[model samples]
Target: MFKVRVLNEEVIKQVIDMKQVVGAIEEVYRLKSNEKTEVFDMVFHEFERGVADMDIKSGHLKGEDIFGLKVVSWFKDNEDKKLPMLIGTTMVFDSKTGMPIGMLNAEYITGMRTGAAGAIGAKYLARENSADLLMVGAGHQATFQIAATLISMQNIKNVRIYDPIDSNNAKKLAESMKELLKDKFLSKYENTDLYDEISKKFNVNFEGVDDLEKAVKISDVIITATPSRKPLIKKEWVKKGTHFSCVGSDMNGKQEIDENILACARVYVDDMNQALDVGEIEIGIKNKTISKEDIICEIGDVIVGKEKGRLSEDDITVYDTTGIALQDLMTSKIVLDAAKEKNLGVVVDL
Candidate 1:
């Protein structure tokens, strides 16, 4: 009697770490590259207002043995109302038997898997000697970007973080991450271990950058994580051989970089269909600056060695991700499997 499982956030976080999420996402990308999976384009609906706004995004992922539909929301300006800005859920099903398997809270999974995609992209696209990393938006998602990059790129030394919103927000996030690192060190060994010891393993320094040009120019990798409708990063400011992971521009008319960047840079998207529909490159396509022809291939193809990424040391590559459904389904499978083994979720007849 295998009934459907409904899970909680506490268990969700415990089972699916960023490293595992990255691996799962990379595996799913491999499956996609091999044509062993089918994922429909995303369905996004937005309702804008003065102070608060909400949007719904839903999608379907079909793999050889599994598939699912996830519906997530973007609740902007929820801070003023003292509520979470992001809230959503995912339902997973077995492909062979058409049986319901699991459902879960997908808010954290969304952020972690998205950041994992950025990290995975950087692993394939960023230079092997890349060290300087810049975070264009230091919000809740910023740490995930930093964390995943730290895990993926072993040589990163400097982390320059900026939030277009303000300096206080950036500074506060940096402080919290430092606390997290210290706590992580203390939890394993002992409280007596100096923070310096922990820093020895991950000796990356964080700086709050107020100048956007300097932030973009000095880094080997740039990750944008803001909800900006207008372009904030300029083409002339970026350095050669740098990789840009554009994560914030997941909707049509929302962009974070100048169109010229997309015109010349070797572009790789998580999904080419979704990229043209509502990714950062969508505006470029609309303006005739770039089109579907400019895209090299999906990140999955690069991961599976079907496409080349960062062919030369001086090439500039942009990985445009529009938040795919396969990512959510893979992450949910990991959490669901762990929950079933640990008996951690609420089980009910469905």
Candidate 2:
């Protein structure tokens, strides 16, 4: 008989938190730099051009002796049917014995890990005194991006949100962030020290702005989480010391920032090949504004001290991520271990 731990969203939520996921993501990058991880090619497909799509990402961590695959799908019309727009599942295996280990609902994991990615970028690349942040595209992913940044970077004092498509979306997201701080962190955390630390950041100013140019100009850090077909941010509006965590543009032809920004900035990516193919840097490469040699280094290299992140305070740094499969494996490992210790999930024999 073969047994496997099956974890659902509720059980996973009870066992794991964003802080744990953030640590796991940081560890994975260090592993990558050490040549202890491998992310296989990704397979992406569309159902109706832009309406729906799915992607399969598979990878293994040699040091951990585990391999896994994450299957994530996006249905634009699912919200109307009262279902989640994004659904994800992750399955893991023991590399040594070639046996199934566990399976988990990875929708929440996806959001948390992606959030950690952006936060880590800011931690390593952004200026030490970055106090103002601009968030573009106030959608589901935007909440995680904001939460992770606020948790990781204590210097941020103001958060400005802007959405060109709908001003109400920006307003609602600002309200949701306030609720998240009060309900999720202030009242929920069992750790007293964490609660005290989070309480101090509770008074952060959250504003919804209609002027994208003004918001981008005054901000010290900017994170874009939209899937726009063209650029939403212009080059002239950005300052010299601004750090951009481009979370959108995961597919070809989708871009959030102008290619001109890449020409003058120090570019960093999660994976070089994937970034060139589908990440935010793809637009720059296609436009001939930046060449392959212009990329500084992968974030992993910087994490392991093989490369530098920000040479000077005035240097513009951009982190373009394509969502590697190793991230799913590492983050899932955290949830699976926590679930096992707490006995939160059911064990199924097959």
Candidate whose TM-score is highest: 2
Deviating ranges (above 4 Å) for candidate 2: 76-80, 185-188
Q: What digit string (tens of lDDT, one per residue) describes model 1 on residues 1-350?
A: 56999987877866666666778888888888888777754555666644344443433445547787787666677777898877788888888887989889988888889889888878889998898998889877888788777767757888888899898778777667766644432233344443344355356788787888887888999999898999999999989999999999887689999999998899999877888888989999999998788899999999988889988999999999888888888889988988888888898898
Per-residue lDDT over 1-350 for candidate 2, one digit per residue giving the tens place of the 0 to 100 score = 76889999888767766666778888999998898988888888999887999999998898789998999899999999999888999999887887888999998888888988998899889998999999998877887888778878879999999987899999887877788766654564566568777666666999998899999999999999997889899999999899999998788888999999999999999988899999999978987999999999999899889999999989999999878889988888888898889888989985
Against the unseen true structure, what C-alpha lDDT does each candidate score?
0.81, 0.87
Q: Which residue runs of candidate 1 sit more than 4 Å off their true CA positions? A: 44-64, 75-81, 181-201
lDDT agreement of model 2 with the native: 0.87
Clash counts per candidate, in order, are 0, 0
Instruction: Tell me the TM-score of each prediction against the true structure.
Output: 0.90, 0.95
